[model samples]
Target: MKSEPVAGVRPEVKRRAEQGSQQLQGEVQKLELENLLRTKFPFDAIEPVPKGEFGGDVLHRVVGAGGQSGGTILWEFNRTKNWSDAWLAKLRDDQRTAKAEIAVIVSQSLPKDVETFEMVEGVWVTHPRAALPVAMIFRLSLLEVALARQSTEGQQTKTEMVYQYLTGPRFRQRVEAIVEAFSTMQEDLDKERKAIMKQWAKREEQIERVMGATVGMYGDLQGIAGKPLQEIEGLSLQALDAPVVNNRSAAE
Candidate 1:
């Protein structure tokens, strides 16, 4: 059963996010995030929760052709000056209330350890700009799970196992691996794109000069070389653990 939202935010009781100092900024960020998700990911349905809504700032439902269910994601946006551990517990309760499989908090201020994005205590924390890319990986996971469920529609045993795995710690570990891999790639791409754009006026022309001419071939070169070729250098990539310094040739 759905709970009817109570209206009004009590400034005295709930600060920071509820009719508090940064409420206005938080609200704007929430709306902007909603718009970004909708524009980038057409497959999912993004619903902005009313001001007094209990669960989260936004509800993201994964929808496919013929109304296929791919689970849901609960998003909470914050533009506060400091990070709060309280949000995690609050969102966990909200996640249960909304029956969302994933809970994500997009904020400018994150935990000391987390720089860009990371899963902390089963909740996803990310910077606002990186939110879209992080969300793309999440949506893909949901879709993959949906497809698996579809294939095992009649097999109750397999379905049960799948459900178990999803709720299990191993699932979280696997998802973390997926997120880390994607995060590394995303970081590398941004760093490389900027470096390449600066070095060559016509990037396509430069790619042809290097080994393998076509775009696909250029991509293969990147995959094989891991980092940008020596022709492109003077760029620093903070390796997350400890981002490596600018090297002449980051090539394998």
Candidate 2:
């Protein structure tokens, strides 16, 4: 016979197991949402708050080009329960602690009125499927506002430069002129390379001509030396043969 589970032990174990599973799911959701936000807004600063922190799950700070913080967005993740007013209140309190300009909840279960995202008591509620777009909208808005404030605070020169480079005809004309100069320089380099190659060919022809003339002169000298040597040998032989009779006749 199979033994039955203990009276309170089984229920407690089941409750703990369920609680652990929910916690795991919630953590996973938080990580996924954080990764999505980070990828979508790489220029912004993303910070994941520690567990039991006074603020929300993630904090996004709008960072300017100069590495200054502008606006903050507090993000919360809820997977176990449906969207409720209590969560909104909690987000509001967390926002104050986080010093955030916007508060959002990325939940698995959205409220009845919210198909994707809607403002519920000033807190933005978004489902997981629409998290990226919703977060992007908030991040871009905050960035625009931050940049505007920065521009008013004597940081307009760089912004003006970017604008002019993007839209000014003079900047385009300067770029075109630089490109044309580079093209002309490349063409001149090609022409110089061709001229050098031609010079090398002419030098090679002159070298070949000189080598041919040297070889011909050497052959002519060899021929002239051979003829004189042959003539000397012939005279020596003829004198050897007739010399004995001549000497005797002279003496007589």
Candidate 3:
């Protein structure tokens, strides 16, 4: 029997659905990784909590490699644009009250080009690196809220200032100077690692060449020593260098 023609879906619709699904999955994965990183490295810095989780408002900057006293201060804003003027004033006051030495901004609205705090350039800034503000800000605010809970013990339900510090411009400048110096140092280290790799590669090539030459010579000697010509030459044999020195091939 002839059946009615079924409605067909457009290629564009399928593509869009796939793209949206991929985006949602990526966001979910990012949040999970951020949470895992935060949990494992909690004491180091105030990492952004996953969306729909607590501690989205508090931003934590690492002191050093997840180990050290007096870790840097971190802060995040609230989503929903629900922050009251009074609360903001209180946060400003807290910023003054906490008297933190360094401030790290990890907002989703922040530009990727931002390396460090505007007030202090040495400090590293780690925004969500996402192009969407609403999502990033929401995540940042979520982290902020999480941090606030820890600081205030859930006494203040709504978002409030987590910390504030009164420090001199010199301190900010020092932080910037340190960050700049650290950047330079990291560059130097990378260059050194590459250089070392190159040198090792060269040495490895030389060792392989010498080993090949020795194998050829050994085959010639073995032929003279009455070994089967085919057996001596066809085997994958490697001969050691003179001085019987230990060969540290980069390949090894």
Candidate 4:
């Protein structure tokens, strides 16, 4: 049996398929770079620019300790395209608009003599392998320069005031002074409490003696009033045996 003739693939279909494959590969590369940046610099902030925003793939903002913003770096990625001068111009524009200190292009293609990163027309161009290192260098250098400027301009004096106060020896001395004052106050309070308690005891003893005398006077008055001796004895016994009010229960 004769086999049917096979049809050749159309040129347009092949071209579209190739383009789609390249697009997919580019996306994968972008994601890998993004993840690497995020993992390498956990403290820094990394954001992907939306399409038609800055013509940049990612934006990285360096963050100092205590959540202070340090500097900005703008990044662009190229997979299959050749390096072009127009890209540098676009990067410069984007850097200005983003207020970024550094602009970098990570590409798979590089000039014949270029091995890693090189400054070309004020924009940094690097291979994929060197992208992270280049980015880190720019970020740290810019951050250090910014900090130095701030220090020289006295912009950081207010920020450092609290830190100095909390960490200085004067703070420790003040704390010790407070502790000593509190101890003295507590000792005085204890002495005053004891003195009040002693005075209360003395008053209670005097009251008891007065109560006994009053009972004795009542018995004498009954005798003078000419009551019977049996009734007088009973009244005197009752007066002397009267129950005292409990001050503690009343206070409670």
Candidate 5:
């Protein structure tokens, strides 16, 4: 039987892949155009054309114009062969940009490869070797732009921690069930704990009142002038010496 395409892949997935491929092609074509333009001799001159004839005329013109010769120009152009399709394709596919960047450092060829990296907060962090050919370097810059655009999708589908734990079919129903159970048990536990704490607090107040009366009686016996006050000085020190009793202290 003939093989068929796998099912369940949404049409949008295919569309996105196609769109990415198209973009890659357009980028590659732009690189090629830049490389070709760079090769044209009059790229910086008044007229955008080869300056002189190829053979003898070029030689005589160069010799007559100045000290430099046609051979020197040819040699310079040959050196620029670094800006080739093969090199650009290498850069496009290479995942280990670090190695390539290292090679760029040793070569010290193109100024375009000297890149200024910025922080996430938009601060200039570092400027690394921008040593690759201009066309390839510019094309690689596009990858950073593509990465920024791709990151937005992650933000678009951003989920809270609770959502991650409780997602999928029947999610809301299961979550509600769990929440209802927790709520019911939690309320009873909280009520019992609060009641226990309230009882302790009542006992604590009674003890304080009794201690206040005792202090007053002692002051009266000691013949002090004013009503004696129950000044609880650093009872927290006593509590600290005692064993920890739950998050709320028994004395507290």
Candidate 6:
């Protein structure tokens, strides 16, 4: 069945609402990425790009002490409802402007061909949660490339083999495996969390139901036995309400 626009709602209002939501979601993902890169990731330096800059949103670097290690990874995060082809072109341009060797776009929406992550038009496109694994792979690639450069003088064939492996489909498979594992773990955690919450809610309802029955039974005993009925501590509200009743009597 086809759905129509919400009754009596302006299209402009809906558009603004969606834009606001997307902006908020993007901010949250950006903050999370910052924390992971700063604390957990192996990047030697992490830099946040300023707004309206002609570069990527974040710049990450792996620096080795006067050794074979120097590369920059550019990152862009998006949370829009749909994927935009323009994003890939723009990030590529930003990658060049920032002189980053690897450019990654972490978006909520992926291109039709991409499921978890993929190299599209020379740029990496991935789900926001899978961004770390992608970054790690690229980070390792940079480190390995550095090592390869140092060793290539003596073993050119071996270095070329390593380079070939890094760029091959096998490398992409490894990334997909890591991303799939992380995504599965996250999905399981969410399910467990929701199940536990549902259980708590059900238990609360049962408790409330039992209390209601108990209170009703107490009231019935009072009606049947009149003054001879014993008052239950928590269930009997008459004693507490007696003073209010007497005050009203006095007022009358």
Lowest lDDT block of 10, candidate 3: 78-87
lDDT of 3 by residue, 95-144 (tens): 33344333333433333344422332233234444312333343454455
Which prediction has the highest TM-score against the true structure? 4
Residue 182 in model 1: shift from native, Å? 37
lDDT of 1: 0.79
Q: How accurate locally is residue 26 in candidate 6, as Cα lDDT from 0 to 100?
A: 84
For every model shown, the clashing-pair count is 2, 0, 23, 0, 3, 0
Residue 57, candidate 3: C-alpha displacement in angstroms: 44
**Top model by lDDT, which number?**
6
Question: Would you list the clashing residue pairs of candidate 5?
Answer: 113-130, 113-131, 114-130
Which one wins by lDDT: 2 or 4? 4
TM-score per prediction, in order, is: 0.55, 0.55, 0.28, 0.56, 0.21, 0.53
Which regions of candidate 3 deviate over 4 angstroms? 1-168, 228-252
Q: At residue 50, what lDDT does model 4 achieve?
A: 78
List ranges where model 1 is wrong by over 4 Å.
Answer: 1-22, 50-53, 158-252
lDDT of 5 by residue, 1-252 (tens): 997866767687888898788667645543443344345332221111234322110110112122322211110111221323333222222212211111111121223443443221111122213212432333334344345545564555446534643663235434544675689899999999999999999999999898777766655654654446443443434643676567666557
lDDT of 6 by residue, 1-252 (tens): 998988758888888898888788788889899789878654378889877877668888877655445588888888878899989867776776676778899888999979999999778999987888887788888887777667666656877878876986446545655675699899999999999999999999999999889888888889999999877876767653555456667898
Model 6 lDDT at residue 111? 93
Q: Which lDDT tens digits does candidate 2 get at residues 40-147? A: 777888999867878588888887666767688888988966456678767776776676778889888887878889988768998889988887788778778767
Report lDDT (Cα) of residue 68, candidate 6: 43
Runs in model 5 lying further than 4 Å from the true structure: 1-173, 224-252
Reference-based lDDT, residue 230, model 2 = 38
lDDT per residue as tens, model 1, 1-252: 997756555553565455564777677778888998999878778887666657678899988766788888999988878999989867876776677889999999999899999998879999998999998899889888889878877767877887878886456646665776699899999999999888786777676566334445645677788865543332222322365655765653
For model 3, state the Cα shift of residue 90 in Å: 38
The worst-scoring run of ten residues by lDDT in candidate 6 lies at 168-177
